[model samples]
Target: MSLFAAETRIVRDQAGRSVRVPANPRRVVALAPSVTEIVFALKQESRLVGATQFSDYPPEADRLPKVGSYIRLDLEKITALGPDLCIAVKDGNPVDVVSRLEMLNIPVYAVDPRSLDTVMAAILSIGDLLNAAEAASSMVADMKGRVSRIRQLASGAKERPGVFFQIGVSPIVSVGTPTFLHELIESAGGRNLAAGDTPYPRFSREQVLALAPEILIITSMARGELFQKVKEEWMGWRELPAVRNRRVHILDSDVLDRPGPRMADGLAQLFDIIHPDLAGKY
Candidate 1:
C-alpha cells in the first residue's frame, strides 16, 4: 500500500455503509449496561460523560450522570448533557424516543448485534465509531479466544444433558431457540428441552413436568429473590429427574441473560454446571 493510502482513513459498517467519526469523541452516553460495558471495553471510558441508571459496569461507569432507563429516556435530560455520541440498542430503546432525539439533532447509533460473533463485531463497530478500533478489536479477540477454548474443552465430554432454562419461576419461562442464551446453553453441551414453536413463550407446569428435564436452570433477576427458594422448590417433585438428581441450579441474570462481552463467561458458567471436572476451569 502507498503511504498516502496507508494514512488514509476508511470508516464503514459491516453492512458497507460509510460512517463519519470524530477524532476524539468526548461526552458520550450509553443507554444500557450491556451496551455500556461494550463502550468501556473499547477503551472510551474517559470520553464517556453520562450513562443510564442501570449502566453500571467498569466501576467508573457508575460515576457518570444517570441518563434514565433505556426504555424511558429523558429527552430533556439527554439534550441537556450535550453528548457528542450516544450508544443505544434497537430493541431496548423506544423508536419514538430515538426519533425525538434525532429530531433534536442528537447523534444516536442504534445497534442490535445478536449472537457471539455479531456481539464482537458490534464491539469493534463501536470502536470504529469512536476511532478506537485497535482497543475494541483486542477486547473482542480475547472473548473469541475464550469461546474457542470452551468449545475445545467440551468436545470430548460425555452425552450432553437435556437442559431446561427457566427465565422465570412464578410464570414458567425457558430459554427458547433464537435467543442467544439458548445458543449459549447449547454451546455448554446441553440440549434445550423447550424446543419447538416456543421462543421465550409462556409455559405451564404440566408442560415442564412432561419434558422431564435432566437439568433445570433458573436465571436470577436484578436484586430479587434469585436463589434456591424458587429453584429448590422442585425438591418436592421427587418424580422429576432433575429434582431427584439434584441438578437444579440458579444463575445470575447478568451472567446468563445479558448478551455482553461476558457471554463467554456465561457459557463457561453453563459448562461448569453441566460438567463436574470442567467446573471453575473456564
Candidate 2:
C-alpha cells in the first residue's frame, strides 16, 4: 500500500470527482469564502490551515493564513501551508488551481453550491469530509426549519412586491433567475424584476426606472457613507415606486451573497423587508 493509503479514504465530491482525502485532515485549506464559512459552521475551523481572501465572516477566519483570493489563488502560499486537503467552490475557485493542487497530491474536494438547496448539500458533504456529520445535519435542519417558517409567513402576504436587487454600483448589476438573490426575493414573497437567463445582468438606470420596482434593495460590500450615498442616489428617482414609498433598503452583501448558514438569516431579513406587515406579527 502507498504511504497515504491507510490515512486517507476515497469519497466523491459535489463535482462528481472522486478524491482521496485525509481521514482526519489536520491541515485543510478553503479555496473560497463560502467554503471557509461552511468549515466554521461544521465547527471544523481547527482543521483549516489556510483560507482564501475575503473569508472574513465569523471574524476568526480573517486570522487564518491567506492563500490569495478565490479567483486569483496564490499557489505558493497554499503549498507552504502544507494542507492535506482543500475545499473549493465549483463556480468561484479557478479550475486550474484545483487541478494543480491535485497534481501536487493535495486532495481537492470541489463543492457546487449555487442555491439554498445545494448549500445544504454542500454543508452535509463538507461535514462528512471533516468528520462533523452530526454538526452538519443539525445546521441543515435549522436552515430548513427557518426556511419553512419564512415560506409559511410569506404565504400570508396579501401581495408580492416587485424587487430590484442592485449588487453593483458602476454600470448597475442585478441578479437573474439562477442566482441566490433571485431565490431569496421570490422566497420572501417578492418578485425579482431581473429574473432572466443572464445570471448577472447589467442594467441601465432607464431600464430599471421603466420596470418600476416596488422595493429596491442594494447590497454593498462597502460600508457606512458609501452605502448611504447609493441609497440617496436611488431616492432621487422620484418616479420609482420604491423611492416614493421609501422601500429602498441596503443589505449586507456578506449575509446574502455567501452560500452558507447565514443564507437563512438573509432570507429572514428579506422576508421582513418584503412584507413588513407580516414581519411585525412574527
Candidate 3:
C-alpha cells in the first residue's frame, strides 16, 4: 500500500461503493446543500473546506468556499480547495464528477438519503467518518422520539385528511410515492392525493379540483409572491373542502424537501397542519 493508503481506511458509502476515506479528514468538501447541512449539524463544519451553492442553511455555510451547484460541480474550484475528502449525495451530485474526482485520488464518500430512516443513517455514517458518532446518535434518538410521538398521536385520529401538496408551479407538480414528502404527509395522518409510480407528477387544475383534497399544502421555494398567487387561485374554488374550511397552507420548501436534521422539525410542522386538532397535544 502507498503511504497515503496506509493513513486511510476503507468504508462503504450509501451507494454501495468502497471508499478509502482519510483517518481524519481535516479538509472536506460537501458536494450538496443537504450534505453541508448534515456536516454542520454534526458540529464538523470546522473541517469543511468547501461547500456547494445554496448551502445556505445555518447561515454560516454561506461563508464557506463554494464549488458550484450540486448538479453541476466545478471540478477546478473543488481541486483548488484541496479537500482531502468530498461528501456527495448519490441522487443530487453528478456521477461523472465523482468518477473524475476519484481518478484524481480525492476520496469521495457518497450518501443516498431518500427517507427519514435513510437520512438518519446518513447522519450516523457521516458522523463516524468525521469522528462525531456520539452527536449523530443523540440526534437520531431525538428524531426517533419525535417520530414515535407523532405516529402515536396520529393513530388516534378517526379520519386521514386528503392532502394535496403542490411542490411546483406553472405546470403544477406534486410529489408521488417515492418522495419524502409523501411519507411526511402520510405519517402526519394525511393521505397524499398524488401518490403514484411517478416521483413527481404534473397535474392540471381540473384534475386537482376533481381530487377534492380536504387540505391543500403548497411548499414555496423563494417564490413568496407566486405562492400567494397560487393560494389565491386555489381559494377561488369555493366548492373545494380546503377552500371552504380555510385549510390551505404554505410551507417552506426546504423543511420538507431537504433530507437533514430539520426533517423532524418538518414532520412536526406537517403534523400540525394535517391534524390541527391534535397539534399541541403532541
Candidate 4:
C-alpha cells in the first residue's frame, strides 16, 4: 500500500462524525492516552509523531512530542507536526479540539470504548484506519479470549460479593452502571453497590454504609501518604464487612482508569482480588 495513495475512505468516528482519512497515513498524532495505547498495541507507534502529555503508556510514548492534553490541545504544535491523521477519544478529548483539528483539514478519528466489547471494536477500527487489520484483529482476539476465560471461572463462583470501587477519596467518587469499570466489576463476579444511571456518582459515607459492600477496591491514583490516608479512613469503618474481613484493596489507577490493552490485566487482578479460590485458574 502506497503511503501517498490517492485513495480515501469515509468512516464514522465514535462521536458519530464522518471523516475521510488517508489510505495509508505516514504521520499521526493521538490526543488521548487510550488512543496512544491502541496505536502502540497495533505496532504502528513509529507513525505517531505527537501525543498528549498523559500518553505515558508503553514507556516510549512518553518520549513523543507533547501536544498538550485532552482538554487543552496545543494547536500550533499539532499543526507543526503535519500529521495526516489524529486519534481522539470521545470521553477524554474535547469536541472543540477535534473540531479545530478538522477545521485545519486534519482527519480525526475519535473512539469511545465504554465497555469491553466496545474497547475491542475501537482497537479493530483503529487498526483498519492504520492499515494494520491483521495485528489489530489478533490483539482483540487475545483480549476477548482472556475475558472469556475469566467469565468462565467467575461463572462457577458460588457467591458474587458486593463491591465498592473507590475512585476518589475526598468527595467519594465511584463508577456507576454506565462506565466500563462497572462492567469489569461484574465480569470479575462482584456486584457493584454503586450501580446506577450516573457514570461517575459521588456517594456519602452513610449511603456506603447502608449499601454494605463486602469488598472495597480503592484505585488511588496517587501514592505514599495520600494512598495510606485513603486506606486509613476506610479502616475507621470497622463495622463494614470489607474492613472487618480485611478485604480492602488499593489498586493501581493506570490499569483500572485507562480503557486500553492493559484493561485485561486489570480485569484479571480484579478477579484475583474478588475470588482468591479461582486464582491461577484463568
> Which residue pairs does candidate 4 place in steric collision?
none
Give the Å shift of residue 260 in candidate 1.
Answer: 1.6
- Please list all clashing residue pairs in model 1, or write none if there are none: none
lDDT tens string, model 1, 168-233? 766887777878887787788788887665668778988888999899888756366546677757
Poorly placed runs, candidate 3 (over 4 Å)? 1-6
Question: Model 2 Cα displacement at 241 (Å)?
Answer: 0.7
Q: After aligning candidate 3 to the native by TM-score, how far in Å is the CA of 273 from where it should be? A: 0.6
lDDT of 2 by residue, 137-205 (tens): 999999998898898888878999899999988889999998878999999999999999999999999
- Model 3 over residues 213-245: C-alpha lDDT tens digits? 999999856555988999999999999999999
Model 1: how far is 181 from its true place, Å? 0.4
Angstrom error at residue 5, model 4: 5.2
Tell me which of candidates 2 and 4 scores higher on TM-score: 2
Quote the RMSD, in angstroms, for model 3. 2.0
Q: Which residue segments of model 2 deviate by more than 4 Å?
A: 1-6, 280-282
- TM-scores of the candidates are 0.88, 0.96, 0.96, 0.95
Q: Which candidate is the best by lDDT?
A: 3
Least lDDT summed over 10 consecutive residues: which range in candidate 2? 1-10
Model 4 residue 139 CA deviation in Å? 0.7
By TM-score, how accurate is candidate 1? 0.88
Query: Model 3 TM-score?
Result: 0.96
lDDT (10s digit) by residue, model 4, range 120-159:
8899999999999999999989999999999999988999
